[model samples]
Target: MPQRRRNNRVAVSGATGFIGRALSNFLESNGYEVIRLKRQHFKSKKSQLRTLLKGCSVVINLAGAPIAARKWTPNYKKEILNSRINTTGVLVDAIKEMEPKPELFISASAVGIYDSYEVHDEFSTSYATDFLGTVCQAWEAEACKVQRIKDVRLCIVRLGVVLGNEGGAFPKMLRPFKLGLGAKLGDGHQVFPYIHLNDVLNAFWYIIQHETSSGIYNLVAPQMLSNLEITEAIKQRTKKSILPVIPEKILRMLLGEGANALLIGQKVVPDRLEKDGFTFEFPTIEAVLDDLIC
Candidate 1:
C-alpha cells in the first residue's frame, strides 16, 4: 500500500527545464506537493539541501545543461560533464541524510552511453567511451551512490530524444521540414532513438507507483528508427520535398564533437518498462508526426 496523502511530497531538481516543467505540472495536477530543487540548492551545504527535501516522498534529478546547445569545446565539454555529475552528487549527499528518505530517486541519463548503430536495452553491457557516453556514465555513477542508502530505491532513466511540439529538439527539427528543406543527415543510416514527451512523464509516474520498479530503464519507444525513415515520414506527412543531403563532414565542422550526437544514435528500447506493463502513448514516428505536425 502507498503512504498517506501528507507524505506525498516530491522534490524535483531541474524543475525548470522542458521535461521538468512538464513533470512538475503532471505531479501537481495529480495532488502531489512538489518542491522544486534549484541550482542554488545544490551549491549550499549538504545539510542545508536536506532541509528543502524534508518530508518529500521522491527526488528526481533532471538538472543539467543542454547537451546540443553549443559546440563541445574542451571547456564546454567540461561544463556538460560537471553540470550533471555535480548536481547529482549533491542530491546523493542530501538524500543520505533524510531520516525517512524518499521512497525512490530517479535521475536523468541518456542513450548516448551505448555505441552508435547498435541495438541496446537496459541489459546491454557494451558501453561507449566518447564524451557523451562518459558524461552519462559519470552521471549515473553519482546517482548509483544512493543505492547505499537503506530502503531508498534508485532508478536512472536513459532518455532518448523526447518528441513534443512545444520544446526539446522536436520543434527545431520541424522548422526545417516545414520549410521543405529537411534532408538526410550523415549517411542517413543512424538510428533516431526517440519517445513522446507524454510517455516520458508517464514513465516517471509508473516508477513511483510501482514499488517493485527499480534499477535502470531505457525510456525510449520500442520501435527502432533510422534517419532515412524519419525524414521520409516527415516529408510524406508535410507534403514536402527532401532537401539535398547534408554531408557529415560539414556537420562535424559546425558542431565539432557535438556532431557525433546528431550523426550517430543508439538503437535503444524500453525493454524493462514494457515487461512491467507500461504502455507508450506514441510508439511510431508516423503516429508522432500525425499528432505533432497536424
Candidate 2:
C-alpha cells in the first residue's frame, strides 16, 4: 500500500449517502482533511464551486438518486438524470476555473450502463439504451469533460451492487431471507456483479494514492455471481426455507419500471481494477455474505 497522504485536503460531493459517508470517514481516519460539498454548495455560479473546491487535492463525485428507491415515472427519471449530470457538469466547470485544480476527480457510474445480457468490461462498448443506461452515459460524459484540463486526472468508476452490513442493498436484501421468505428472482439466471463495501472504499483510496490510474473501471469483485448463486449463499447463512421463485411479472407489477433495475442484470468484470493491481478483500458471494450476514 502507498503511504497515506495525511496532509491532503479532499473534497467530496454526496457526502451523506452510503458510499459517500464511508469514503468521508475513511479519509478522515487516514488523516486527510475532508470537505463535504453539499448540494446547496453548487447552486450559485461556477465561481462558488471553484471556491469550494480550491486547495483540495482530490474530489470525489458520488451524487445521484438511489436507483431502486421508486418506480420510474418520467419526472422521477428526470430527477435521476439531473441530479447526476447537472451536479457533475457544475463540478467540471468549477475545476476548469481553479488555478491549481485538484489532481484527481473520481466520479461514479453504474454497471447498468452495460446491456443486460452481455458480458462487459472496461473495454466493452455494449451499452444499454434504457433509462438507467442513458443516465449513466450522460453522467460520465459530464465527468469526462474534466479530462480536457491538462493537469487534472479523471477516473470514472462503474459500480456494481455494493454489499455491507450497515446500509445499502445488503440490509434490505437480508430482510427477506431472515424472514424465511428467501427465494430467487426471475429464474435467478441473471448475472449479479457485486463488491463488498470495504472494497468500494479501498478502490477510491487506491485510485487517489496511485496517480497513474485514470479512466473507466468496473468496481466489482473478481468472482461474479448469478442471482440464484447469491440467493443460495444468503439462504445458507440464514438457514431460511427456500421460498418459491418470484416471477419477473410480479416484480414489475410491484416495482413498476424500477423492477427492471433489479430483475434485469449485467455481467460486469473488474478488468481494469484487477489488471491495475487492486485486490478485493471479499472476492466472492460467499465471502461477501459471510462477512455481512453473520
* lDDT of candidates 1 onward, in order: 0.89, 0.88
Off by over 4 Å in 2: 1-7
Best by lDDT: 1
In TM-score terms, candidate 1 sits at 0.96
Candidate 1 global CA lDDT score: 0.89
Across 56-130, the per-residue lDDT of candidate 2 in tens digits comes to: 989899998889887788888888899999999888888888878888899999999999877898999899998
lDDT tens per residue, model 1, 1-294: 544433679999999999999999999999898999888888777877899999988899999999988888998998899999999988888888888888889999999999875679899978888889999999999999999999898999999999998788998888888898899998889998999998999999888887788899999988898988888888899898878798999888888999999998898989999988889888888778889987
Model 2, residue 193: C-alpha shift (Å)? 0.8
My TM-score estimates for the predictions, one after another, are: 0.96, 0.96
Q: Go through the candidates in order and give the C-alpha RMSD of each one to the true structure.
A: 1.5, 1.5
